[model samples]
Target: MTSPLANPLNRRLLGASALALVLSASGQAFAQTTPQTDETDDATTQLSLGKIVVSAGVEKIATDTPQAVTVLNQDDIDDTQASTIGDLLDDVPGVYTAGGASNLGQTFNIRGMTSNRGEVLMLVDGVENYFEGYRMGAFFSEPELYKRVEVLRGPSSSTLYGSGALAGVINFTTKDASDFLTGDDRFALRTRFGYESNGDGKLGSIIMATRPTEDVDLLIALNGRTSDDYEDGNGDVVTPSDASANSVLAKARYYIGGDRKHSVWASAQVWESDSYQLYDQITGFTAFGTVRRRTRDEAFAVGYDNSFEGNDLLDLKAQVSVSETLTDQDGIALASSLGYASEYSYSTVQARLENTSKFTLSPDWTAFVTAGLQYYSQERRNPRYKADGSPLSNGATTHPEGDTTRYGGFVQAEILWRDKLVITPGLRIDHTELSPGAGVVVGGGSTAVPEDATNTGYSPKLAVLYNLTDYLNVFGSVAHTERMPILDEVYSRSGTAPVNLNLDPEKSDNYELGASLTLRGLATSSDRLNAKLTAFNNTVENLITSASATSGYFINVGEAKYEGFEVEAEYATRSLFARASYATVDATNETTGVLLNTRPADELNLNLGYVLNSLDLTVGWRGEFVSGITNYNATTGAVSSTVDSYNVHDLYATWRPRSGSLAGMDVRVSVDNVLDDYVKNNLASFAGQGRSFKLSLGKTF
Candidate 1:
């Protein structure tokens, strides 16, 4: 079989062709309103062009950010009725998930970089969620706990997020008590229930929000879910897909100095699941046999914010957070041969202090400078036990234990000239050190300790955006960043490869160009349309990757190149809305000219909906199309088997009443995979979910 969108040149032409048509059509429309930096009200802030991005060092509207960015609000999250966090982001352009059908195995991929390689940064309420292990995945949390998610694509984010953000950054914001409070009401209680037919999945949740004092607000939420193994489109049961999980979220906020400008807040979240499943969660089943596994993930954070109302140069925010993820497995059928049951854990502690200064530089120039300092420490541990419940004498080097410490400081400056041109420049410096755990053994059972490895790197970026006209804007950016080695790459010295102490940091140079189009008064006087197209090229030097288990351990090989394009457009009115996005990426190893397997297939997502104000009802249809890919190997001049293209469609309806007897009630209904077509994500290891009907009901008092 042959793939249609596999050639790099063809993909580039496709993007160019689409862009030419969009530009031509937009030129004929007249501009009605000019864009502004003023923030929109909460009720109307969900609009794609009006939404503000808090993850950026200095908040800016998504369209004015000069990067490929996406923001999903609470409404979007609820409409999907997603079971896992990954499901909430699957439709985002340039984003994909691997690890197959099990929720526990889902991991995120951006551009062509996987999260396991520390290329993509994941954060929850400003705290890092870092975990990497064999056959396991990253980011295990409840999607119901979050109200907002922000995705900033490309290496330009490295200046604010971290050094390893070669692909991008994703930030999840938790819900607050204020989100549930209504006028004159000091307390609120909410109950929600949901069911899915495909896997017989059931979910129950309860939340309480209260204001004990005029200066304090508090909230607590509890959620539970259970499901059996689900069937694929062919009606075949996908083994090890059963799930039983519980989660809790608590948050509080307090005002100080009788002024809300000075406030403090804290939050805690915990999620856990215990069950018996296959030893290999990534691909489902293997010769390793099944095991009794229990997994726990927890995060806690505290923050302080002061507007400094009288001081224009002292607006400040500070935070400290800690997180831990642990997984334990016992009663393994192959415990004796594998040397025993084991426990794997990753713990992190982090802190950040940031401030933004806004001032006028001249009559025609306005500027804002943001500076921040961050520090984080992570530890990884793997302990094994004998079949008889005794400690193992020899440790496994395949997953060694280690500790990594990193600290960084960054500064960004944004300057606007006459409200038509914006320029942003940023710089960051980070230092990292890796230390092997005590008594850890490596290749050939050697006990000799190795010297600690340390490295320092810097990232710099510059971006410019110019408004060509009232309804069009062009932007370009250049960024250079670095990524330090993680614990696994530095400590694990197994599989016939010796320890390498001279490992160097991976460096990347990324470039991006894009255009934004905004038009109004086309279909109706109050309707608006917004679209953006972005093209990016990145080169990574000294790329770090595994050289196959039989050959060597993780090593810094030659360079790799990644190039891609993303197109996003949205149109909305009082009662009608439509959105569409398309994305494609091509990545290859420069040394052998072989296409990288991490590159995902081209994807297009579309949503069309209408609202009926009289009945307080909304209905929508969503469709997703994915093109297949064929891998190429230059060494042997061979082409690998291809993955067939597939398409999935969904229908949904939602009802919410604001007044009368049905006030404070919400109901949602959705049918997924309506055609029951056999589907498999190009990057996944197993088949996709089959046709299913889902219902969710909630009531607030």
Candidate 2:
């Protein structure tokens, strides 16, 4: 008989078990030795779960919100040391990365919804940000630029976000000068440096914040990243993996008006990446060859906010913004044969105005109502050039140029009946117009004369929450939303196929129910636990099919349904803490009885940490377990293949001196994939990164 310690699998299992047992024993031992009282260490509390969410058109605690949501703050961002945006969000339930593992290749997948299909919406500082291209990710930005990230799951958010939000919304808020200004300090400077061993990656960032006047603050940030090719768990090098990026952020805020209740702000951001990589960023190795690709994203926004303290019916907020995203590719190795060097870009101008009113009806009843109007104009252009740098008379029909303008208005009311019951109702309506760009041509070399299209969409939702007990609560919601057809789907043509001008809007009906449990001093006098379980089912009609080289575009066919459940729990004490998130999602194409390819396998993430208050240090262990998934052909209902399940573990530590000469210094170290497991997610085209040792140092002045 072989010794269990001699087997690699057994070794990993033993490691995991040992870690869990050590954490449990330590926690119990600490509880026994430490003083048992009603008071607990403030630093040991779970702050992530108590975060406030604003993406739902109002401010509510994560546990108090009726819908499913997640919030990651600055501390969480720094601890992850994520290289790509995907890595930063992988721990969230019902959220994962799809496409590839590269910085420019990864995209977000929520439930079974993908950004490529226009199901997901993303925002940076309340400004829309997105780009869609063949085999390319939709949103790209540096993770270091943000101080907070909020994820709102499900289509129920469509009422406030927009009518086409089939998947969910992701909001990123950048750091502000006020965030760094401590006490009466008028200026602050922060610098950070980081390194990763696996890919030999390096990061350098710096920020300067200042209060130039009594009522004005300004901030500027610059960040740069560079990384070389990395090897997989099997010691295979993924080619064309080298990448680099640089970005800048600048913003300012000024307070005006009596009592300083009014304020105005402006911000500008730019992110650019230039790399020589494969044309199809989604796949590492492809026969399409490589190109010199440069991608840039620019955004500018100005806004005004007024609290109107004494006025019950006058709280206003307004904003205007412009954003542009461009991806230019040239020097294509196969351009001579393919006859195309592409330039894809999207330009958008948007404005919004909103107001909130509060009313007190009786001592037990109070209501808050919010209404808003939004307008945006967007243009998508994809131009092609020959190998000699000459413009082509007719561009590729797979991606047609078009303009879209939308006007929308929405109203939502939140009514509270004491602290026991809450009701929320919302409605949104949008009108959109689409027009084809100049020099449009079809696949057969004929000048295409496509007709303009106009459409209207509506979203309605209702949600209720009831506190059955002080320690337990139940919530439920129902929503219906309509998604208008995108330019690519309605205007794209191929082979002998013509433009699809009659594509109907996609409609989604969503239902969600959940419960939460709050427990204090369960095992020890100072321990706390907060847990939530959510179950959701969504049905989408008029699912659009993508066009092929020989097929026309935007054909609305059958229905697609998705059902899932999520569990989020946190436990903490003075010296020990544990957090876990588990998700199970299943989706199918009702028309063909085939599982949706975008569906991810059930996953569970566990994290446990121990704090050494005397040393100002915290150490933690994390384990991620994913289940196997079976793939099937959409049309034929044939088994394609299966992805095997895998488990990966990580170890991390952080130290920040509070009362010493190094008080302003912060240090972090992490060992990712401690076992070097060859992990593969169902939505990914490549295996996950191999074992890596990461370290970072930051200091404030």
Candidate 3:
């Protein structure tokens, strides 16, 4: 069967081609008017024209990185007024979050790759966020706690972030005391209250910062939210959807010396949620029950950063962190006297040390080498029992207790010539070991025991970037990445299914080509345009696939291929802003010659905003479109489900005083799904939220 993207005249193709043409033209025009220079400061000035992303293995501007990346800063976050991380990421091209409106059971998909036993990695403040069971996927947190969010698309990140980052990485950075307090200010406080109509939810938060001394700063924040069951687009209440969540964050920073060249910081966050769960509406599970679910996520980290004052060549950073997640489910059957409970927990401890050394070989040549060592250990435990406080006779665990340890070392070099061309080459070696706990009894009989496995992988990456001009750049990258089979993929079982400890690691070779163009002073004096076009192709060997939804056993699918492209553009002025993004992906199984059912057909986003400067007000409109998709059931071998195309619109307005007595006060109002569209997600499992309204008020002192 022919794929939709195979058609040359497809809108996604045309849009990408048009963007590429514009980039080429802009590059030529800018190149003709400027001459290349060797001053290192000039390169820094050019790259600092936009936000810098530190997660790209180095601190550099997004346009200068040889990969596709998306960054949302504080201003962008405030404009959207989102409550959840999923909501903030909904409009990003090539990104999708499953599970509809609920935060639990949510999964993330990048390009055409979904989570096959943890392919995408999530990080908070550079520490890993781990999950154990297959049913519960990604982590969820309130958006107010984050100061910035960065997403890296593709397997290129595997060189720096091991195993789980085979698809990509998403990092969230929280706020600091210095962000709110001025030089002389000793304390700062901010508070917010919000309400949403669909779920009748209420949100409240308070953030406090204090500087006890010139060398010490502390920050603390608390957020709470509660909501009833929300209605779908058809005005039907989704059962077991009521939820309540609370989160707290604390951080402290201390300067080690008077010069402040050496600094140490500590931070911690705790988030807890209580919700109700029911069998998926489409699953046809006749067993009805009232399930009380609770989840707790905690993270803590300490880090030190130092740039040797006497040694101009060395910069060092070291960090250690621990994170844990626990989930419990308690339920009672409606028709039967049966009752049940289950608990799953996962924890990770990690440490990293890195050093960067710079060298000036000659006037036109300079180089920097970064080397790092990382170590992490993961542990998971799952237990099930009856409501009568007795262990299940079957003794079969949902997810058995397991432990995994990973150690890795990597080095990368960046070499630049005349500040116009840059090349980076890197390599990483990782060793992983997995150990499964004792066997469990099932149906009064012993189940199959799990075996231990150890694996080693070598990843290599090469990237090149050429500056066509200060405002336009073209880049390409090729990487070979490997992912070891996770504990769930290797040891999970159902009934008598044997553990799959013999499974081989999944490996992929990824290639990417892209261009970035920035045009300042386009028409108006304050108008600027930023655009990006990226194309990628990846092939996987020994792809891991689930044998059945009910059975936890997995099998290798031999080989598969994925190809995709994304286009994004944003135009902004002092008072007006507009943005558009589009993406398309194609994935196929080589042996069966069938398309993979992991990705949506296509996605597009459009947003426009205007600022009434005199009145301190801003108004915006946003629209999103997702093409229809078809999904096949691996177990049934049939077209099990289909989802129709959907379009949603949102309108929002915000007012913030810039001066006078109301100076730090803000008020916002927003309406989502203005058309009341009856939209279903690509998975065809849950309907989208109906038309909803939100109002917020905040003040800072």
Candidate 4:
């Protein structure tokens, strides 16, 4: 399945985005001044074969990439100065935030789509970081350790990656020891402490270093924390006693640079994502306590990328990896006096390669084409059946088995038509195999076979940039994307149909047209002001939605359409900076003709920051107004679960002492749910966290 780009809603994202860009500009301008570079960092950013890369976001490359991408750098992390994975995600437009009720597992939503359903992909270095629970969030890695975050938004990304890119990709790049390591005996450390209105206390520290001739680079980091249940303005306890945890991360990198351009490196990690919610209901605030989960995950691999100069100039890279995760979920419904428990074990092995060359077709144009293939396989298990935290017994015990296989290849090419115009078009094709174990009845019951299916999908994307002038660009794009049904979807088939496949691939088209304007900073600004306007129309085919109310089986309703606009603007100067974004979505279900459930129609984000040599403080807040929504019963024509509009806020600050050698060291703090809004998040899923605060310290040597 392939979707076309939204020609109408493209304007919406561009328009709403302006609100964020404006605040970001001013925020940076007021923060601090260093070198005369494209960034606000103390170190200058350079361009070369592989000059130190800024993954947070690569500007010209971001604009030139065939897909729509966003970047949030370490500075952005520091400015917002967040403590949890959920806090950093605010920079991403169209993404839904979760896990606020507890610091356990926060889920992210993209384009009104869910993550951890294997819909979105999260990669750290080269390993997948996200796992499944009731909710989804980043792996147990410290955000302060990151250098940058790149978000590739959309299924058109499937060609580059396989299974999970259905909603696009989030590539998290970690800071290399050498990038910050200094002196023959390198060493650096950071410590932090914080307090919250909910009686939450946090303390942590990290230490890193390397040995010159020992052929070993070592890093050690840890985070220890504690928190209590919080009461919102409405006077209700959100999840409390979110099990405090002690986490540690270690790494070792060896140098094999005998071949100069030829080198190989590998790393491994084992971490825990655990949480215990003391309260049951956060929506209206529940009295049910004692909810918990624990996930032990480990990923380790070795890969090599070698470059060779030949007639065609080929750069070859390949890697094979084995990763596994074990998750234990436990919950007790106080009212029902029911305790439910289940576990899932997953292991995956994958390999991939790519070859690319730049061709000098003509004096006025250049072309680069890339081709690659990736394979992924996994085994999953689910033993008990439950609905809305309630036990459901039919045939008694249920053990479901499932595995996935994906083989795909894609090629992207760019044509530079003179110095001002560029065009990029890419296409990918994939073949997938989905197989699940048959179901058996408990204690000598009947046995039934589960159906399996194979599918082939294609994704294509195109982006054009026409530079009206040196500082302005007008661009347009159209693309198609798709994703096969995931493991859970196949296991939970509806109505016991004698079907080969339970559902069709979800397909969508995002069309866009937008413009960017760069203006000179007004004050003693060493930076530039940016303004963007975009309108877009997003159409999804075979939109699949499930419900637990009626043994919620996955079903395809009909076509769904979402149209919107976004505006983003920013101003960066030496003394002050500001950035802001605003988005309005008009989403509708064409068949039933009702507002899409949980799809917010209006959203706004704002951030303002200022840096006073010894102290760099920032205040930021985001507001989302979920318009009224109703669920329609296909046969009865009855509407259920009506929701109202609401808003949320957050505040952050950082302090750096100028007098001591601790120049690069600073303290950062943040408070989420400032107003303590008691907004019912997902009625079927769970509630959100109450007002909470976190503090962290960072240093560079």
Model 4 local distance difference test score: 0.56
Residue pairs that clash (backbone atoms under 3 angstroms), model 1: none
- What TM-score does each of the candidates earn? 0.95, 0.92, 0.91, 0.80
Candidate 2 Cα deviation (angstroms), residue 221: 0.4
Native-structure RMSD, model 1: 2.6
Residue-pair clash count for candidate 2: 0
Off by over 4 Å in 2: 1-44, 257-260, 283-285, 333-340, 442-446, 547-552
Better of 1 and 3 by lDDT: 1
Better of 3 and 4 by lDDT: 3
Q: What is the C-alpha lDDT of each candidate?
A: 0.81, 0.81, 0.75, 0.56
TM-score of 2: 0.92
Q: What is the lDDT of residue 477 in candidate 4?
A: 74
- The model with the greatest TM-score is 1
Residue 538 Cα positional deviation in candidate 2, in Å, after optimal superposition: 0.4
Task: State residue 51's C-alpha deviation in candidate 4, in Å.
Answer: 14
Writing each residue's lDDT as its tens digit, candidate 1 over 1-701 gives 23334454665566576667666656666655434433352223335656788887678778877999999988888888888777899889999987746566467889989887778888888667776656666778787888899999998888887898899998998888888997767999988899999899998999999988878989999999888888888999877778888999999999887767899999899999887676765644567866777889888899999989889899999999998889888876766655568887889999999899998889999889999999999888777888888876333565667888999999998899996999999999999998888545445345567678898889999999998887788999999999888766766675466556666789999999998887766666666667899999999998877653433366788999999899988777778888878899889988878888789888878788888878989999998877877766534648865777777889999999979988989999999989887777767766878999999998988
lDDT of 2 by residue, 41-150 (tens): 46335445656788786687777789889999888999999999998998888898887566874578899888776688888876667655676777878989999999
Better of 3 and 4 by TM-score: 3
Could you tell which candidate, 2 or 4, scores higher by lDDT? 2
- How does model 3 score by TM-score? 0.91
Per-residue error for 422 in candidate 2, Å, reads 1.0
